[model samples]
Target: MKGEHILPLSQSGSARNTHIEDHLDGSSAAIKVIVFGGLDGILTMFAVVSGCAGAAISPLQTICVTLGTLLASAFSMAYGEFISCKAERDYVESERLREEREVEEKPEMEKKEMLDIYTNRYKFSSADAHDLVELTFRNKDFFLRHMMAEELGILLTEDDMTPVKKGLVMFGSFCILGSFPLIGFIGNFLGESGSDTSRIIGFTTTALFSVIGAMSLGYFKGSYMRQRRMISALMMALNGVVVGFISYLSGLVLMTLFPEASI
Candidate 1:
């Protein structure tokens, strides 16, 4: 059955690394979701910490806000990814079942539809379409498999952990990445006596992380090293600017609210 073939492809991999590679290459949508989610979390937390520092808030306050934001963002992102992936899986499954029914009840019509799909996709002539259809339909099951794999590109069965696993990975990765800047803040603040030194350390750490992430993503996508470096630097700089602006605004509000505070 088509389901048998499809199921193998879906589950073909070592359990340990399948999810990791899948998130990297399964669908562009999944990759983008994870990348952007991490980027946003990092930027958001960086800005919050910077703002607190700007407002002259104590190290303790900064740590509290950064940790709070990290936790909240991670949970929200994870849950959102879970729901979205589940919906996609459900839609794919529903379509597979519909295709299965069509194959059972209207074999000839389904064959014609499959031919048309391939014909339009590959731009084949009428004679070629008929020839191709005949060749594909030699085994009834083969024809259905071709239609499912080529025309629909949806599988009959999938890993139970697909969406939930992906969500957890994305959220956890983001939280970990985001915490870098905050950790920098804590280290600088606790280790150094001067606020200025701490702020510099925090900003440098944030920028470094952004550059590294961008370069990694670009390299994985097979872009030129020089171009990727430039792109990464630009993205990091842009992130810094946006976060800096937010932090400035937040600092203003914080300072107004806490007149007794050093800020």
Candidate 2:
């Protein structure tokens, strides 16, 4: 009797499952920027609000300060991402063009260099290295790809997400996510009289939300659970202090300048 054939379990799944898994594994650059950038904004704003509340400032003033900070931070983050990506792309392209020109002008030298690189990596004999180098040089694209990968540490064919798109996604996510804690503060303040109890409740609520946001970001970024959680907490706390200081100072100034104005 003929031996029975068997298929591997891993190979038996539907192609759709494979496709879905591959897609999921592909990291979205936009999502990454949003997650990190949003965390930064939320942490900063939360710190500001906490500080203002600690100083016994009005909820309205705290809200104003948080909003201003959020807008400024988001814009700055977006612009920075754009410029950085643009610079990277420009550098990579310039290097690639220069390499291509070198290949045309000094084919034999470039071939020898490629041989040396591969020989050093694989510990191949000089004759075998020469043969491999000749084979690679016969295909310009493949030779260039190898050079780029080894020398420059860049993929020749992978599509980079547009910097503008990344910037917009980051800014939008930051504005929306960072606004949650502030919204909680506003809601609490508007619902109750401006008393110490109301202020405490508002601040506590804001912190709680900030913690949740940070934890979520950490998990999404594949960070170590304990470290990420603590880092997130500290960042948010620091933000609270900065924002609070600014709001308190503004309130003090306004109070001094117009004593009649209820700050």
Candidate 3:
């Protein structure tokens, strides 16, 4: 989502980095996580619900299957996210510890490395790079930070969310957004158990809900990423339609294979 900038020589790289960071700061990160989780939830549930509806299964059966899928998917998504994020955090910590030892044991070597980075990579004059490195070395923490960023290419910053928090967000988003398409299935509980009219209504409601959810996700994504909202919306809607159609076809195939299994 970022483009190359033609910056003047006078501009500091740190300033440009700060501006780039702003795009993902504040509510942006949470928004991103929520959108990601919500979209996954909606699409997955749509697949299941549409599949069941296409198979002409009993409402109770559809409800049972959808619920099972929803809970299973949510837990899976949350746990996977937690482990992935924790691993990343651990790796970063390991790097930090290694860098800390180098800073403490070989201060001069670290200083020279940082000086070379500034002079060569950042295009700082030799004298300026020397002064900057000298100034950084005055503070142990600052030196380590610069080493992490300049030498190791890892920027140290506090995250707004922890791994646990991210997982919880994913679980919540998946459960909530995924429930939308289930509404139609729930309607079957209101009418005669296996009536074709009720089943049709339920499937139609589920399809409508899926479309709305997909479009909403697309709109939010486009707005945050500064893309064309209409195009994004259409793209996401198309995905929903394709998934739903494929799911329906799969259900038809399954039904044909096991005619005796129809409830």
Q: Once superposed on the true structure, which residue ranges of model 3 sit more than 4 Å away at CA?
A: 1-24, 116-132
Q: Write the per-residue lDDT of candidate 2 for residues 71-110, one digit (tens) a residue.
A: 9988998899888777766777777788889989999888
**Consecutive 10-residue window with the lowest summed lDDT within model 3:** 1-10
Q: Mind giving the per-residue lDDT tens digits that candidate 3 earns over 143-248?
A: 8866776665666665667778889999999999899888756764666566777778788888899889889889988988789998998899899999999999
User: Model 3's lDDT to the true fold?
Assistant: 0.81
Pick by TM-score: 1 or 2, better one: 2
Query: Best-fitting candidate, measured by TM-score?
Result: 3
**TM-score against truth, every candidate:** 0.68, 0.74, 0.82
Q: What local distance difference test score does each model get? A: 0.66, 0.70, 0.81
Judge candidate 1 against the unseen true structure and give its global Cα lDDT, from 0 to 1: 0.66
In angstroms, the error of model 3 at 194 is 3.0
Instruction: State which candidate has the highest lDDT.
Output: 3
What ranking emerges by lDDT with the best candidate at the front?
A: 3, 2, 1
Q: Is candidate 1 or candidate 2 better by lDDT?
A: 2
